[model samples]
Target: MKQLLVPALLALLAGCATTPPTPLAPTGPKIDTTYTAKGQSSRARFLVLHYTVSDNPSSIKILTEQQVSAHYLVTNGPQPVIYRLVDENRAAYHAGVSSWKNYTQLNSSSIGIEIVNPGWTSTPEGGRLFYPFPQEQMDVLLPLLKDIVQRHGIAPENVLGHSDIAPLRKQDPGPLFPWQRLAQEGLVLWPDANRVANVRPIFEATLPDLFWFQRKLATHGFAIQQTGMLDQQTRTVLSAFQMKYRPSDFAGNPDAETAALLEVLTTPANAPLPVVPTPVTTAPVPPLPPATPPVPVVPETAPAPAAPLPVPTPVPPAPMPAPVAVPTPATPPVPAPAVVPATPAAVNTP
Candidate 1:
């Protein structure tokens, strides 16, 4: 009994030694808390939007079980529901490998919204089809977005799409997503349409080159390398911007119009700010693609260059035989004129 008792006491003491420490319990002045009004603010300062390529059930399974999650998952179906997965206070793994403006690893300082939709379909023919978010889903989204942004005091500039943050790896909430609609709701910033129109003609006349576009894009908070080359990364950044502003066309090709839009967005340059539309009614915007997927198109190929013009064959010049020069008698070499040696002049002794 003595042996057992000693061993137990020794084990207990060792366990206690290895255990982690907890906050000390207050004894005297239980709290030294200050009741001051001034204090720190929330960690979140940005909001990132994304679309799950899978349906609601699949998205939930992937987000939860796959160790990747979002603060909220919005659904569009028989009954639209906004499901809160991770608490807003905690970080979610939704914005992976992302950066926008002054933030990086955005999961640290951003609230991520994942809406359920078939993001994009790549047909066998190598063409991509991006689907638009349903009206029902967006109706639920507006209030939620407004609340999040307002509560965090997030800037309009900080609201970004996942692709806007990770252009090379993501293209979510694709072109069909009505960013302009969000802008009207005061959730995101939009370029003044009138400003774009004013600058477009100027740009077309003396188009700003690649460097100008890159600089403006970087200033607009895109994390792009200023390589001044038409590289893939540059194209991806252009595509992301087009998706946000000019959903009508996002072929990823840089043009005078694109440059003009960037210029307008970055610097209005004496242009008046557009008033936010109170009752958002978009015109000329196509209603989301019909339920039936459009016919798959074969990837575009370069047309064969116009057949080369025929070159006229040149005739070879007639070969001339070496002329046999008649041996002209060698004329006597002309005698060189003799140079007379002049006498050196005597130095004058003054």
Candidate 2:
């Protein structure tokens, strides 16, 4: 019995001795210590423009308290004020259920600016009249937009309205909003009147079907459904396009004029046009396109309004201007912020 107990204890001791010990964690040089950036990029790739339908106070509440938010808000009071709500480095919950070209979920890489406006005013005739942005609002907004575009290196084409991204759902910064003003400032592209003049005659003879328009709209970055029929979706896309390009009349009805405008935009800038041997008449730049350009329901109905020349799609940022380090406003930026003048001055980007 003694020998058996001794042998059992010895066997347990041998088993314990044969077990391997737990290994210690290795410690030596730190990884990725000498880091060097391969290339450069901007935190924000797109700048989406919107108009808060709610008035100043309501706009503030909807933007801050509600689920929706914007990086900046421009007020429409006597004194137009630009308020910074969301930081540029972070995402804002402004664009939803949106797509542009191949990009979707724009909130991930876009900076949104909400302009405060009554948006739609009640008409005695039981209709809604979309209001235009004030001169003062555009004044501050221009500089602020310029600053953002320059700092972030946003392309002229990438500067889009809420409608441009979500044509079916949004119409803010509506038909009355002055897009040509941005075009004149080189922040966006405006269709060339001359090109439209040359193309209108051709489209009048052979109007392309709805399918062509849908394809062009998609190519130009409006997330429209291609049903090959003139559906509500197509009209919304037309309205959105006309709101920006032909604000004079946005009936959502596609006409020869709309078709021509679409063609001009899709036409290659380098594409050649017919040239006749005559005195090149300098086209009369129509009185700075009206606040609302008259939309003709049908192009053949009257001396057709020439198609607006094609405006190029958003381009890359390098040639326009590189972005700079913007001062991050902690809250709604109410204080008189330094304006980035629309000039040749270069911005210091980090």
The Cα local distance difference test for each model comes to: 0.86, 0.86
Off by over 4 Å in 2: 1-38, 122-126, 273-350
Give me the overall lDDT of model 2: 0.86
Instruction: Give the per-residue lDDT digits (tens) of candidate 1, residues 46-163.
Output: 8999999999899889888888899999987966898899999999998888887676898999999999989888989997888977788889899999999889998888898998
Model 1 segments more than 4 A misplaced:
1-39, 268-350
TM-score of 2: 0.67
> For model 1, how big is the CA root-mean-square deviation?
28.9
Task: Give one digit per residue, the lDDT tens place, for model 2 in 60-176.
Answer: 888999889999999987788888999999999999988888999899989999999878987999867987787888898999989999999998888999889888888878888
Q: What's the C-alpha lDDT at position 265 in model 2?
A: 80
